[model samples]
Every structure is written in C-alpha cells, then in structure tokens.
Target: PRGLMSLKSFRDCAGEGMKAMMPANTILVLAWTISGVCRDLLQTPLFVKTMVADGGISGGLLPAIIFVVAGFLSFSTGTAWGTFGILIPIVVPVAQAVDPNLVLVCLSATLAGSVFGDHCSPISDTTILSSAGAGCAHLEHVSTQMLYACVVAASSTVGYVVSGLTHGSLLPGFASGLIFMVVTMLVLRQRNKQKDAAQA
Candidate 1:
C-alpha cells in the first residue's frame, strides 16, 4: 500500500497542497496585515480636517484631492473596502460643507481611488491571489502591474478634476480622461519601441 502511494499522492490527500503553499509566504502575509492595522490606526481626525479645509483647497480641486488621499490610504492599508469605510463618511460631510454640489463627484472619486490603490498594492488580497493563481512571484506580479495602475490613476485624477469643476457632470470628464489615457499609452508604446530598436 505504501509503495503504491507516492509523496505527491499523499500531499494531495492530506491538505498539504494548501498547507504547503503557505509556509514560505507566512512572513509576508503577517507583515501586510500588521501594516494595514498600523495605517488604520494612524488615520487621524486632524488629517481629515486639513484635507477638507476650505481656505486653500477650492471646490474644483476637492474631488482630485479626495482621490489622491483615498488612493494613498488604500495603498497603505492594502484594503479598498477599509478605505471606503473610513473615507466615505468623512468625504461626504466635508464635501457637502464645501459645496453641496460637489458631494457626488467627491464620493465617486474616493471610490475610484480606493479601487485603484487596492488593485496596485502588493499587499492587497486580490493582488496576492492574482499572483498566486498565475503561479508567479508576488513581487514580480506587483512590479509588472504598477505601470498600468499609475497610468489609470493619473487619468482618473484628471477626470475627477473635470467633474468637480463641472459640478458633478462626469460625461465630459470621462471622455477627456479616456482620450488622455489612450494618447499617453500610445506615446509610451512608441518610446518603448524606440528603446528596443536602439538596444537591437
């Protein structure tokens, strides 16, 4: 009986397939969890107040700022849902106070930013699962995806700005942002081609 079963067969039967996958990645998993907790702890009320302060930050800029801030928070925490839970309540009231009209745009920006950051963060569960599912190194997956994430984020930032300026009308902002993203990608592709040619 023992001779008939190979190590691979035993591993498949005893849940070793799942258990073996975790030992090497335990440190990384713990580190990510700790960092997320620390980030949440440090999200202070003063920071929220400063971000929404009306003197220097105009209504037109509010959405863009919220996007940037939410992105940073989500990236640090590696959790888009957590970022949304923390930010939406604060964003809504502050945006309403600043300009009741800008509230919807600001909320939209916040949600988009959270997703953008979580998509890119190495510590995010989706990112981890994606790398694992692809059977690639986690860091390799993160590095490869970072460029695209940054490009999308920049486009979203521009879109949020336009939406805020237009009093929450997203169509024009969305169109312009799409155009900007396409043009930027084309330019980058051309540059990469030139570099490859030079190398050759």
Candidate 2:
C-alpha cells in the first residue's frame, strides 16, 4: 500500500494551507496587539478617571455609541473577530467605569454590531466566500444583502438606544426593535408593489 501521502505532497499541501491562512493570521495578531495596548491604557488610573469624567458618553448613550463605532470599525476592517478583539477590551473597562450596570448591554451591542458589519461588508471574508460558494457576482451579492442588513441595523440601533436609556431592560428594547423592523419591511414591500404596478 502506498503511504497515506508522500512526504513531498504533504509538505506542498501544508504550504498551501499556510499561505491561505496568512491574511487571517495577520489580522488576528494585529487585533490582539491593539487589544493589549488598550487594556494597558485602561489600567492607568488617570485614563480611567478621565473617561469616567467625560460626561459626553453617558450611560444612556454608551450602547448606541459603541454599536455604531464597532459596526463602522468592523465594516472597514472586514473582520468581526478583529473588531471584537479590538473593541471588547476598551469597551469593557470604559463601560464599567461609566456605568457598571451597562457592561453587559454594551458588550452585547459590540458583538451585534460587529456581526452586522461583517454580514454586510463586501470585503468580509465570509461575505466573499459566500458569494463564491453560491457562484454569484460578489458585488451583486453585496448589493442585494445590503438593503436587508441596513434595515436590521437601523432597528438594532433603536433597540440599543432604548436599552441604554432604560438601564439595560431587555424587553422594551427587543419589542421596539421587532416592531420597527416589521413596519419597515411592510412599508418597503408595499412601495415595491406599487412601483411594479406602475411600471407594468
């Protein structure tokens, strides 16, 4: 019986695998470095004190702000994991200092925003791979998905605002978001129907 794989074959396969993973590995390393630096900065008493003193990012606004920032960063970078690594460390300490009760809500917002960005970002690896796997044009896939992603994102932003304002109450935030999403979708569908009728 031939060996499971010849030595040369195995080496070539391993090399290819490493080459494929290089970009992801580089992003992970960079994200980790940024997180570490953020953690160190947060540890400084002066930094923490200053952040707490900054009245601009009050508890009522922190979740919405974090969500937007995390979403923007993840969209630009095209990697949710990197966004998580970069934002979580910074957001955690800041949230705790600003409002301990908001820590969990802020964390959830960060994760949700990162995922939302990754879902809609054209450059995201998952988005690219999904299009490739479906044998569709990448831009077409991005464009089609963007509309729904934007709707969800809008509703989520509202939910975050409500949750933050309510001091982390989950029900009101969730219900408001769900209702907003449903109404938005119904309106879009009706408008599309009217436009189609007019065209026909």
Candidate 3:
C-alpha cells in the first residue's frame, strides 16, 4: 500500500550508501600509496645500477619490458592510475638514460599497458562498473573481453618492441601492429566458425 517511501527512508538509504563507499575509497587510497612507495624504493636503486651497468637497458626492448611491468602492476593493484603513478618516474628516467628519443615511446607503452591490464583485471573498478552498467554478470563480461584485451596487448607489445628498435619511429610499428591484430582476428574468427560447425 505504501508505494512511496518517506523522507526518512531516503535519508537512511543515502547514509547506508555513504557508509558502504567510505571503506572502498579508503582501500583504493591505500592501494595507490603502497604501490607508489614500493615502486619508488625499488626503481630508484634499480635505475642507478642499470645506468652504471652497461649504460642501461637496450632501447629496442626496454619499452616492451616496461609495458610488461606496468601491466603487471596495474593488474595486481586493480588500478591503472596507481600503476601510472608508480611507473612513470621509473620509466621516464630509465628511458632517458637508455635513449632520450625513446622516452615518448616508452611512456606510451606504459600507459597502454596500464589501460590494457585494467581492462583485463577482474578486480578493476572500471571492469566492474562497466559490467554493472551493462546489466550483465561481471565474470561474463570479464571472460568475454579478456580474449580481445589479450590480443590487443599482444599487438601493443610488438608495437613497442618495434618502436624501441626503430628509435621511436612508430609508423612502421603501428602498421605492423595493425596487421598483426587483423590477422589474429581473422584467425580467431575462423577458429570460432570451425568450433561452431563441429558442435552443430
């Protein structure tokens, strides 16, 4: 009979929402802080040693390596922004030391990797919110998107590798990455068709 709730009910709902959100916010902050601190501590010394030893990492492979590391950090933290904060400092200085021209390429790879990892991570807020907004199950969305994300990640890894080798010349790398993605998609589509036919 009481279709509309009272103002007190609305206020109670709002209060509960705030209470639920507060802890989540706190945990995100803690996650960001810890990730940043640990990366800073390790990277500072690691970069120093890297610079002193063999003039740092090779430009051809460093971006790919940075991408992998950034991706891992983002995946584990479930926060791309936190991964960026943790990786930028290390990536920039190390990239500069390795090859000043490759800094942009390395930074781009780091950003791409962070985003890719966030999209793939089950715990990432963006992934959760996307599934919730789409009115679908979170695991279903994650499982469906994971394949596409991994394919893109593979293409990006190759692109970064080529860019690093080419002294930050991205055109060839971009073209190659695009070709790789297209070919991979076609192969996957064919495989899916075969699988469906077999099932039928």
lDDT of candidate 3 over 1-200, digit per residue (tens): 37588888989999999997885677667756764675575557365437545776566888888889888878887888877766776677777776888889989988998998888999998899999999999999999999889999998888888888899997988987898999999999999999999999
Ordered from best to worst TM-score, the candidate numbers read 2, 3, 1
lDDT of each: 0.81, 0.88, 0.82
For candidate 2, lDDT tens digit of each residue in 1-200? Answer: 37999899999999999999999999999999988876775464336537656745456778988899889999999999999989888888777877787899999999999998999899999999999999999999999999889999999999999988888889988998999999999999999999999999
Candidate 1, 142: how far from true, in Å? Answer: 0.5
Rate residue 199 of model 2 by lDDT: 100
Ranking by lDDT: 2, 3, 1
Better of 1 and 2 by lDDT: 2
Candidate 1 matches the true fold with a TM-score of 0.74
Model 3 — which ten-residue stretch has the worst lDDT? 44-53
Report how far residue 163 has shifted in candidate 2, in Å.
0.8
Model 3: CA > 4 A from native: 1-57
